[model samples]
Target: MNALPRREAPWAPTALRELRRPWKLATFALGLGWLLYGALNYGIADWDVGISLLMGGLTYLLASWSVGRLAQLRRPDAIGLAVALAALFAAWYCVDGVYVLYHGLAGNRMDREGNFRASLLLYFLAGMIWFYRGGLAELRRDLIRLIPRT
Candidate 1:
């Protein structure tokens, strides 16, 4: 006999189910925000802008899916995916911070525009950290499960 419990109904769509998790939801939301921001600011008039936004948005969705898989199975490939995402976000944080600081300090007065950009970037970083923590906790839990019981 099958051991798994039967579902009452067909499962929700993959993206919908995965995004039920808070971390996943945050990541997805931020990604959409960026996509919309790009569309609005860049107008998608040029081929480069259109393609870049398309690719970036798709990548974010894939990353969200990876986060969900990591949470459930702690898959080996998912670990690598998480590490890559972490590195990407960390690098972005560093470069953006340096850019904002240099420009903000270059002016005699405080740069409000730089301040706004920095704040948005900080929120994005925080979302990534939150998503990373959820994956890390799942990995830790699975590792402990593998230990031989006394």
Candidate 2:
């Protein structure tokens, strides 16, 4: 008897799926909170908090997308270029996070150490890496299954 071909369930893109993660949802919520806080307390002058949060969220999404795209590229030179771009993106985020955290600490009168902001951003960075790896795995698996066997 002949075996039937396997059918897999339809799924969303890896980058979009990353947004559905619990931690990512939390980050979006936190971004909204920052937006609200900045608007109510100090207007556009203090908009950095909200903007940083939004950027952080976008970074996670884009990193996942990058990993997914990287997995599909066939050329060695293209892969190397993609890797370099990804690294540069990550480094930029790190520097931006530090700047945001520094400004946050400078603005806060009561919290001299800025421990809370630092820790929160740190957690988000770790979450971004986690999301990227998860997306890579999922996309690679799908790509592998798409390959035709002789």
Candidate 3:
């Protein structure tokens, strides 16, 4: 008989291991480069740019934690679908941000009505996501129960 010894976990990576990943390190370097470029071109006086980047980074990392938790589910298709939809949302926001920033720098502003409409649309989309989160949580619970323990 060659039965393996019982282990207690569901073990995951250590914080250090996560930080040392090559992809993570590369992203960190890229982020620093972007910050350096921004400082040089936009100047250190641009609080908006700095704050925006910081907030975006925090949001991104926090969101990853949520997704990482979901990654444990047996049915991974839900995770993939969530990622795809979120990517689309992020892409739309990125394009809109670029458009707005370009116009702003060129001394033109976004049309007030259009901006308001877009804001409303974004709000609705976010609301829908908030609603969907409940279902995702329920699904996670169900899937976890379905997973057989060692």
The lDDT for every candidate, in the order shown, is 0.44, 0.48, 0.42
Candidate 3 lDDT over 3-23, as tens digits, reads 211211112244234444455
Q: How many residue pairs clash in each candidate?
A: 0, 0, 0
Query: Model 3, 125: alpha-carbon shift in Å?
Result: 18
Cα lDDT for residue 2, candidate 3:
14
TM-score of 3: 0.30
State which candidate has the highest TM-score.
2
TM-score of 2: 0.37
| Candidate 2 lDDT | 0.48
In model 2, the Cα lDDT at residue 16 comes to 56
Q: What local lDDT does model 2 show for residue 41?
A: 76
Model 1 agreement with the true structure over 28-85: per-residue lDDT tens digits: 5775576567647854342133333443444444433333333344344655565556
Query: What tens digits encode model 2's per-residue C-alpha lDDT throughout 1-150?
Result: 111111111134544555676655665577557655764776444345644565555454454344343444455475456564664455445435544565576673233245336534554454444443333456568668989999
Selected candidate, larger lDDT, 1 vs 2: 2
Q: TM-score: which is higher, 2 or 3? A: 2
Candidate number with the higher TM-score (1 or 2)? 2
RMSD of model 3 against the true structure: 14.7
